[model samples]
Target: MKQGTGGKIINVASMLSFQGGIRVPSYTASKSGVMGITRLMANEWAKHGINANAIAPGYMATNNTAPIRADEARNRSIQERIPADRWGTPEDLAGPVVFLASQASNYVNGHTLAVDGGWLAR
Candidate 1:
């Protein structure tokens, strides 16, 4: 992308970047790398009109997290930890993604927007 027309690069990151799961070492490491790359690319491309950012989503009730949600106790515990007191929905992240992709956020760069129902705040 750097060599092509200058453009925005949005990275899909996860809340795991801020917190670690008990048994998911690789997932955690990968997300941390996403954040690192977002920052690095943003710094390198600022002068060329290319923006880089990341979106870190919380436990959305998606196919990937269905197993966790299916466990009643686990689901309840997860909800309690989030300030919003509920699981996130894919729709909840749409606005952030749109904002980053549009000219409305031209000044924004190297930011990791968390659509996690305030999970990281807890």
Candidate 2:
């Protein structure tokens, strides 16, 4: 974006970015860093027409979460915590990702959009 063509920089953060999770200190720290740096980038690059932001997903059903999902108790507990009463699917992210990547979000910058199905809200 330094060349001024303008661009979008979408970084992936996590619910851990906003809160600490058990047994994942490194992951939590990194995700928090992602959020901080995304904002920093927006502050530095927005003037050049570069929009930097992040998306934080909560309790997603993905390969990486297979272990958690496999544990019936854990899965149930997680589901109960989310206001949506379910784990987030990859498809749930499509709209937010598209919005962040499109001109529709041209005025959006330095924001971390939580596609967490209201997990954070609770």
Candidate 3:
């Protein structure tokens, strides 16, 4: 940013950052740390024109979630919890990433953007 320009830093974190998740205590700790780091970076670098932010994805449909998605009971439970009524696709995160990396969010800083099919809403 010293070169007379601004930069955007987007972190792929998780909803666990906001809530205490089950079974995976370490995962929760690390991702929560990501938020702290993102905010710290934004605070220390904003003067240098750096915009740091994070994306907290909730219940995404991916290999990591294959076991849970495969279990009908668990799948139903998860989908029901999300306001969107479905597990989020990786594609669901695209728009938020674009917005954060573009001028659209130029004024946004140290924010944790949720791309969780509205799961946090519920």
Candidate 1: minimum summed lDDT over ten consecutive residues — where?
1-10
Which digits, one per residue and each the tens of the lDDT, describe model 1 over residues 4-104? 76788899999987777679889999998898999999999988989999999999989989999999999999999999999989999899999999988
Estimate the TM-score for candidate 3. 0.95
Clashing pairs in 1: none
**Candidate 1: deviation at residue 56, Å?**
0.2
Candidate that beats the other on TM-score, 1 or 2, i.e. the better one: 2
Candidate number of the best TM-score: 2
* Model 3 per-residue lDDT tens digits across residues 29-96: 99999999999999998988899999999898899899999999989988999988888889988999
How displaced is residue 15 in candidate 3, in Å?
0.4
| lDDT order of candidates, top first | 2, 3, 1
How close is every model to the real structure, measured as TM-score?
0.93, 0.96, 0.95
Best by lDDT: 2
Which regions in candidate 2 have their CA more than 4 angstroms from the true location? Answer: none
The stretch of ten residues in a row with the least summed lDDT in candidate 3 is: 1-10
